[model samples]
Target: AAAQAAAWLAGGGLPDPEAGLKWGYMEGATDYLFEEREPSPGVAYVRLVPVLRAEPTGHDLIDELLREPRSWRWDGHGESMDWWPAVLPSHREVVAVNYLPHLLYQWNHAGVYPPYLEALCQADGPVGDATAIALAYFLSTDAERGVPLLLRMAARGDLPAAAVGRQLTHLIRRAGHQTRPVVAALAVAAREGAYEQVWEILRAMLPGLLPGEGERPNVTHTEAVTLAADVATWAKAGGEVPATVSAYAMSKRTSRFARECRRLRTQLT
Candidate 1:
């Protein structure tokens, strides 16, 4: 899965304790087994898996989550599942995207927004997971709060920039919300010297900016255009530069991909 791929890319490997043992795949291998090289033993082995996601005892809230509709979308990385309207009745670390509107409405009307927001802020899980996306969208209802929250997370490396960008684009498609705040958050991250991560995030947003072969531009297209324009302006500023801008600035650098940066620069310009 994408998570596994990410772990591998970051130099994470299986926790194998046994030497010269089962090294071949078995049924359900993908679900439980991971392989690591062990030169000392001339082979590698496995460790018994533990419950990675443990639920609190008497966690009755799961019933409410199960009752929500099950819907998801696949990306190059993997699947992302979320419910519509993006709110929840009782805030939990994991939430139903569909119930968010109702949940937010009730919370606001009942003067209980803090508990829900607090839950989103404190809830922990995998990086760039569904809950993170939901939190970004839910917090976005109040940009003053949401934008800074996202920026802080990105700056601190708590949330991946690509995840935040993709989730913001998804939010635009589902909620018809503006993404200016999100773009600004990205700019803040760029200023904090996260140029490489910011560039990947912006690259994820590029699909939204370009039109299909024969399709007419829509509201989403316009929003994407506006986002790109803002990013371009930030790129030209005298402060910390965005990766796209830096790639063009340092085209001779061996690490930079000049052609790709030039292509995106041409579009944004």
Candidate 2:
């Protein structure tokens, strides 16, 4: 049912079950997805959850996704079933764990701040540890969402800072040129008073995002430095800019990178 909603919102009808796989919701999505929607925090997640997650949480969930329109059989009806909006009682929990995350992800791709997932990223308890390990192990699917979640979790002493830091580095590198929104999210978080938590993630992320310590700066690097400066300024950050940034600031007196470095460096003092 949710998958149909995904399909409908994505500008298509429900996909056939017998039909082979589908593309990323067809990219023909209507403007509904951009309306800024998310489920209430009260929506069920940890409660009634399976003690053992089904083999990590990304691909498997996608594999189990319900793409066909939901329908059901009636006792009086012929063998053919009715295809409309209906949920089989048995499939409730299945959808919660398997389909809900993806739906939530589609809605809040940039926010990536799902509290339930954050709750799952706990360290000590079995559920928490399992989730933390699962998310960290195959972060390629989780990077956009999981990286920032880990930062917040680590800040609260729920997960390890070093490990979270490493993932932040991986996220920055993996995102490559697309790291703009990710960086913007951090800056927004800092501007909203998450300075220390955001800075910790940035310290790990910035070096890789920037050109190497003394390597020649390019347009890409220029953008990276500018974004970092935006973050540092918002965070009111109090620490050294990365060596790469500092060296570049000194390398060219008037280039864009140097100018961004000056703005970034000033925040440190």
Candidate 3:
């Protein structure tokens, strides 16, 4: 049925301008069916009915049909299916249904710093934070566009800062810590001195590292302890860590790691 439909449309089996078909620019029509028409060489009047429907089942049907070799042909033959009647609903439907929501979820976040950190905690798997971070970083190059998206994600609590930071670190290590597009985007944000934006991305991730059953694996007690010490040292040197940073410092940890972080912070200062 699908192949016959496709073949018929390709052969102008339904209607044509010479057939005086009046489809009236249907928005979503895969093929046109000729209902009534006056056949003439130079003068013909035909009324066209859209063959494709917009219902979900109809979409599935079209998808199945398009995948079949028998339903479509792309050769340069006369009246080829290549330029036959337009496909219904269009490619925009595919993006709207599948890609855009996932993309928006990942991209509209704090930024790379926190999201990266979160990625480190996930077990090696396909649907991990790592994938999200990679995608967000790819899309983050457009600062004007990307920054707002990040902020939107942050506002929505879709991403956290610590996670982002870890992800960034992972990506840095993967890229040999050298300047790549993702790093460059961060550098640009840093140079622009968008500290609030940077902080938000970072702060969002901090809650995940708090002492709890769901605490992330990447942000171990030792790392958290060391990070706290680093924050203090940075603070003493007139650098202010976000409130979330200090909050994370209060989590449970080994005394040795805690002491070591504090010692490191002091030494660094």
Candidate 4:
């Protein structure tokens, strides 16, 4: 109905120009001040349209929820214990939004992050939401256990697998301490084919693996490099994976990083 009204307005006029308005010409020009004192009898006219009432959409609801207090305790127990009830309803309600991670974290005052994660993973929500949820979990908690789950979500096509890879790189840069576990989890996912964009993930990680001039390679950098190699080897694309990585490495703007990427690409080849 709204579309029809918009279409009607677009095609001509809302009430139609020919019949609705009574125009008069004066001095060979369109009289701007013409007004109808009264309608002539026997002429049919359109009734006035009522004002439209604004209704909230799912996005609107999510916005309204942003102002909600972060801390929560649904049951008698405090944030230390499992607080399933505090976030279950919200998970069900906000899963429709593509950015579920932000919504979930906003409402995670009671330390129910895990429960929110479990609910989102099990609820059959949008794939983007699930992917966001996984990335959010990894960034906030550095929990590698979520990697495979993220891979599964990516496999479902809610979002590109490259997004997960990019987030993994971000996670490593932010919290290098958790690098080992994240890499291990990613290796397992790749071998199992839980996600298909292993090549993209490796490519994004290449620059990070390179050390600046005269700088020594760190533990996290070496671990990440090994992980990327493992993913490239196990990936179904065979030699094409190395070729793609080599192309990206050669195209890099930073000479040092580019040289490093090409070297790594050679090892894979």
Candidate whose lDDT is highest: 2
lDDT of 1: 0.42
Q: Write the per-residue lDDT of candidate 4 for residues 197-233, one digit (tens) a residue.
A: 6555666555554455566555655555666665555
CA-RMSD of model 4: 20.4
Candidate 3 lDDT over residue span 1-269, tens digit each: 77766775576432111101012111134332322332234322221111221222233554453331211222332232222113322221221112211222223322223333232222121122323343344434344544544445444444344445554443333222232444345444434444444443333333433344554334344554444444434334334443333433354654555455445434333
Candidate 2 residue 257 Cα shift, in angstroms, is 1.8
Between candidates 1 and 4, name the one with more favorable lDDT.
Answer: 4
Candidate 1 residue lDDT tens string, 24-93: 2123333223344222332222221211233222324433433433222123211122321143323333
Off by over 4 Å in 3: 1-131, 134-136, 176-269
Off by over 4 Å in 4: 1-63, 66-109, 123-133, 139-144, 175-177, 236-269
The deviation in Å at residue 125 for candidate 2 is: 6.1
- Scored against the true structure, residue 262 in model 4 reaches a CA lDDT of 58
Instruction: Give per-candidate clash totals.
Output: 7, 0, 29, 0
lDDT for model 4, on a 0 to 1 scale?
A: 0.43
lDDT of each: 0.42, 0.44, 0.35, 0.43
Candidate 3 local Cα displacement, residue 181, angstroms = 7.6
Worst 10 residues of 1 by lDDT: 16-25
Q: How much lDDT does candidate 2 score?
A: 0.44
TM-score for each predicted model, relative to the true structure? 0.42, 0.43, 0.26, 0.47
